[model samples]
Target chain A: MTNNSSGSRFGFLIPVIYIVFLLLPIYWLVNMSFKTNSEILGQLTLWPTNPTLRNYTVIFTDPAWYNGYINSIIYVVMNTVISVLVALPAAYAFSRYRFLGDKHLFFWLLTNRMAPPAVFALPFFQLYSAFGLIDTHIAVAIAHCLFNVPLAVWILEGFMSGVPKEIDETAYIDGYSFPRFFVKIFMPLIASGIGVAAFFCFMFSWVELLIARTLTTTDAKPIAATMTRTVSASGMDWGVLAAAGVLTIIPGALVIYFVRNYIAKGFALGRV
Target chain B: MSFSWMAWTLPTAIFFITIFALIAALGVWEYFSPGGGPRVGILRFETTRGDRLFVSLLGSAFIHLAWLGLGGPSLWWALALSVVYAIGVFRFV
Candidate 1:
């Protein structure tokens, strides 16, 4: 009993320590966001001596600032929806069937995911500009698909394969149409997979800066791009920047929370 | 006549539309004819299309990172290598 209790206590300590380590940066960001700019630079304090919401207030009042958040949310949602929708059938195909060069084709798609965003940024800018799409939410959404689609497909395929082939055949024999079978039966069975995929799609599209920044200017600028404005003639608006940073983490945190159960399995790519 | 698009440009609109169209096309194709059973590959073990995809993606990430670390002027070589590696993964892995 003593040995087992000690082992359990040790395991508990590790995660507790890990959680603190992970949260320390976030805590610091929240702390700095509440402090005045001078106070942020003055000394290291665990908590704000004089707490204020002026930084958040500035963000709420400014069109440039608040619009950034809206633009970000819009594109991230569009990307997540697009990625999962596209990936579903592709994942189904990969999971359920064999086709000539299917393996090669799937690999090629993943190679797009592996390709560095920096490499594509210039070409994407040029391509979008050629068609007159310099700064738009849709541009960012589509650009994000280059990575998210492949990842979504990979994740969903794993989940799909776990279902028995007999179920598909049985459904077909029972006169259920393919689309009906897929939408009504297969999808619900893999609901957690879809959730996990959407979570990743949202997370990546939300946090990605390079492609998002490159693809937009003032009109559809993301919060990450807008955050750059804090470094100005008056020196860095450290408080406001910290506040913006804190705000950026909220969407991702909420997503993780909603899909918390599926995340571990999703990260395992449903193989486990 | 000229008009300023609101927070959206032609390319942005086209890009998104094209993606959605492609997805629709895939759905149509799937409706017409369904997929087939898994086949054995060059690898000793049998793998479905999805397993090959997972391996290839994981491999490609490493290949790109290595190419970047090796100080190359262009990733075209890495791209080429990735193609060969992907083929190999499909064939053997």
Candidate 2:
């Protein structure tokens, strides 16, 4: 009885410790966000000595900050849609067909995911520049496709492979068209894969500074870029920077929470 | 745009040409070279996955280097190289 109680106690303690570790940086950021620039550097306060929503008010009332949020959301959605649409067909083809070099093709696709993002950032900037698409949400959206597409392909392939090939053959034998079969039959089976892929696309697009910043100037800068504006020689606005950092976590956390149930049983089942 | 482009331009152009020549040479070399599959001597054969991954990583490293040494505008080479490497893996490896 005592051993079991102790074990349960430790189990409870583990999550508490983990949460504290994770929340500490976030807490500090939020704490500073409520303080004035002077108070942020004035002294250490475990809790805000004088809390104010002044920073948040500044962000909300300001045109640039709110506009950035709108632009970020617009492109993130664009990248997600493009990546999933292209990857779904390509993944299904790779999973179902026994083409000439199926194994080689799949590995090649994985290699794209493994490729570092930094390298692609430049080519993307130049490519977009040449096309006169620079400083637009579309430019960042397509540029992100380089990363998101491969990821979507990989996850969808894993989900697709878990499904029995017999199901596909049987469906076709029953006279279902390829598109109908894929949309109705195959999609439901891999719904979780789509969710997981969307999560990744959102996460990558949200946190990504290099491509987001590179592709966008004033008209289409992401919130991550907007965070950098707080730094200056006159003085850093610790309050706004912290508030922005705290706010950045919200989109990602909400995504994971909504998809938390499906994420566990996804993708690790099979690899085609 | 910046003088930094000069830093990698010479080395990068040379590096790319060398890889192009090497891949072609290896493809040709594969035909004439002796027994294949993990040979210590000349014409070695890589598994399909191995060839695809090796070339992809090799290209990625250079792409990453280009991003760091210069600024990040040459990733087309990485993307284009991977596609070619994929073709090689599918066709030859």
lDDT of each: 0.85, 0.76
Output the number of the lDDT-best candidate. Answer: 1
For candidate 1 chain A, which ten residues in a row score worst on lDDT? A1-10
Q: Write the per-residue lDDT of candidate 1 for residues A197-269, one digit (tens) a residue.
A: 8988998899899999998988999999888865564488999989999999898888888798776655565
- What tens-digit string does per-residue lDDT give for candidate 2 at A127-196? 6777788889989998888778988988888778889999998999999999999999988888888888
For residue B30, give model 1's deviation from the true position in Å: 21
Please report the candidate that would top DockQ against the real structure: 2
TM-score for predicted model 2 compared with the true structure: 0.73
| Docking quality (DockQ) for each candidate | 0.06, 0.09
> Candidate 1: how close is chain B to the reference, as a TM-score?
0.53
Kindly provide the TM-score of model 1 when superposed on the true structure, using C-alpha atoms: 0.73
Q: What are the per-residue Cα lDDT tens digits for candidate 1 across B1-93?
A: 123323578987995796467445544554465452346777667775456655776787789899999897698888788779978886765
Candidate 2 residue A12 Cα shift, in angstroms, is 5.0
Candidate 2 deviant stretches above 4 angstroms: A1-12, A264-272, B1-93
Candidate 1: residue A9 Cα off by (Å): 4.1
